[model samples]
Target: MSSAAATLKQQKEDFVSNLSGGPVGEIHAVAFVAPVAVLLWSVLQSRQSFFQRYGLLAFTVDYFLNVVAILLAKTLYSDFPLLLSLLLAVPATLVYVLPPNAVSPKRKPKVPPSADSKNKLDPLPLKPFLTSYRSFMLISTIIAILAVDFRLFPRRFAKVETWGTSLMDLGVGSFVFSAGVVAARPVLKERAEGRSMPWIRRILGSLRHSIPLLVLGIIRLLSVKGLDYAEHVSEYGVHWNFFFTLGLLPPFVAASQAALAFVPSHAALALLISGSYQMLLETTDLKAYILTAPRVDLISMNREGIYSFIGYLAIFLAGQDLGMFVIPRKLNPRSNSSAGVQRNTLIMTLAVWTGVWCGLYALSTNYKYGFALVVSRRLANLPYMLWVAAFNSALVLALCVIDSIFFPAFYNAADPKSEKEAYLTATSRILRAYNRNGLALFLLANLLTGFVNMTMNTLEANPLVTVVILVAYTLAVTSAAVLLDSYNISIRV
Candidate 1:
């Protein structure tokens, strides 16, 4: 095989290894932690300037992607090698095999720095970790959904199923991620004009825009059959609890911003509060009170009784925090050779993470074998959290490494002009030319999942048929998401 093909194979192997935790979760933790250690070393050395420039972002992305990949794994079949290979391959091919010139870095033209230094400033130092929190929960909830589905129909759907939760997760994740991009655009533009919104005001301003989108989504959801009124409500559609959970996010995020005025370590506080709150809920009498009975509104109907409000609220604050870091500013572009070394180093780093992940999965198999885990429910509590954290950390690590290595090339090819301009131009085109409307796309996916649930509700099919149907439904939803994204982009322009 060619070097690219070999590299691709190696990456896939690593991804699977990390994913499976074959006999125990140790390999999983090792898969991620080891590379992190190495990257830390590289960063400390400062031998590779590219590594230094991107180390923070790389680490952040790594954790984010780890959640994504693991979540995908839960939803995919036990015999996932084929599909998994393809999923990684498609993106990997575009990133790794594509000709250099086709996606080469654009010539760095000397553009004047924006007048407002604040607007032109790089991401806030504290933001990336906060973003990592958002990513983890978003990923975790999706993974949790898959685990729940697998338990419901283990043999029939080898992988976890995504049904009711898809409404919230897809809707919320897309919106937040998109909103971050959206909020950043104007902030950068204002910088170019030499005016910077005070951080506090900026947070409030973002809330103003984001909260409305959340509210609008709720309104749109309510106008439909809704959870309580609909037949087969359990099978698909947005559950009542999601609306409640999501409804609370914006205000809660706004509150966090307010807290920042008094709290010096706002990010740390957010993390502590979120994690501790979750832990307390698990330990306290609240668990019995909340879980014993289900909440019955359109928003709360589909979920387990406990509010998890704090959990989701924490996620929102985390998102805000992350937004701080990811809002990129102008940095001196690296020389060509430096860029290449960065690219190669990224590839190597990904390889390391992948290997570690596989090793962890292999080790995890010895401990216990279950379809998926919910952090709160299991007897092996700390282990479960550790398991998830390890898996997620590695996944995010790999994603960051890949994005870091490939983003410049990818970014350049996407737009030939300024990074900010390119993002705006590209996103604007996406918003205009495609249905980048996440809510609409997710709604359709939920609709299809509902239809699948409706049809299969009574069927006593063989395992093969069940698997086929589940896979079909999954593919359908994924396709719809992509199409909707396209449509959202198309129309926005």
Candidate 2:
């Protein structure tokens, strides 16, 4: 071949190579578009139908697993632990959306039902939830330990390069789990009890109830000194955006309901919005810019922007479906049932799905251009989006099944005037407390983690001592939370 012809060929190869993270790469852009395409089709076609009618849960599980894939696509996407946050939201959303709105006729006559059950009683013995949650926690912890200590699991399986960041990720999970439980109370209560209040009243009520705590969280997040504290710790440690966003979510739910009354078929709209936004971000050359200067712009990277909103919107729509149509009208036991078989099934299903996620991540990373973020206006990647969707759904399904086994009371908290009523009522209060102080708690959690690390680093102690001290601090915080109110929020210690 002539020298000019050879140079042209080399340039073509290099172009392909850069796109695929290789010297001579082959990336199919269609692979990235398929999920969004299918999702759009599913939503548009299924507007009049229920989410369950088309196995939406299964789809959601796949979507969430794909999100984990998105996470592993590159090192840059790892900072935002969106998968874990959404996972924690699953059980809480169910608790909010699924239960009867009317007082259960099952209540005994002598019990007036006026007393607040929350302060006086323990949550009904949902041995399944406690068991499942504890088991999952223990397993996760063990997985983390093994990943850290023995290197027994594959980097593909249990590998995590960043430890401090991962621990903070766990902290976010704990806070989200606890806070969602708390928020579900009044939201669920209003649903079941048949609220006479106007839509505006409901919105205002939620704002009034939550505003104080929200303000406190905002104060912490916006503080100059707090950013200084964040600088001392990990770069992502000073995330106040979650607080502000979470503070807005309940009201957003309320507003969404109001909109539903007007639009009758808003879920389809949400799906379209999410998918279109995703597509725009991917096809455009915007990601290159976002990745270059993430800190400066809100939508530069995944700092709780439209991409995150799309996931949350999908979740909200799902919640609405379950709330309005699914939960109150019980399905077959198969929909619930937390027996050993069911639990094992969920675990295995999640494991398989997680494996699929890992595979996708590996593939997508090796060939980045093959998949793009659905939202071209934003900096989302296909793997990150898929991972969050799949992981979130798996967490939701697992929690629901587990809740079914141990917390049967959740299935039917009908009575407002019995010992059982009191028990169920307390669970609501626990929900309330978490919702009330969620932002504060999250901010506090970061501060606590950062300050510990800062102190340990300054001391320059032995590595073993640092680990021990950090663990001790974690235990102390957890113990205090439990001692304050064992069942009020999660006692993760």
Among the numbered candidates, top TM-score falls to 1
Q: What TM-score does candidate 1 reach?
A: 0.49
Candidate 1 segments exceeding 4 Å error: 1-76, 79-240, 275-284, 291-306, 330-374, 377-394, 410-435, 467-493
* Cα lDDT computed for each candidate against the true fold: 0.38, 0.37
lDDT for predicted candidate 1 compared with the true structure: 0.38
lDDT, candidate 2, 345-431, per-residue tens: 545654565465445544544546545322111222343333333343344444544444433453344433343443333222222
- Model 2, C-alpha of 306: deviation from truth (Å): 7.3
lDDT of 1 by residue, 69-97 (tens): 44444434333534543554455344434
Give the TM-score of each candidate: 0.49, 0.48
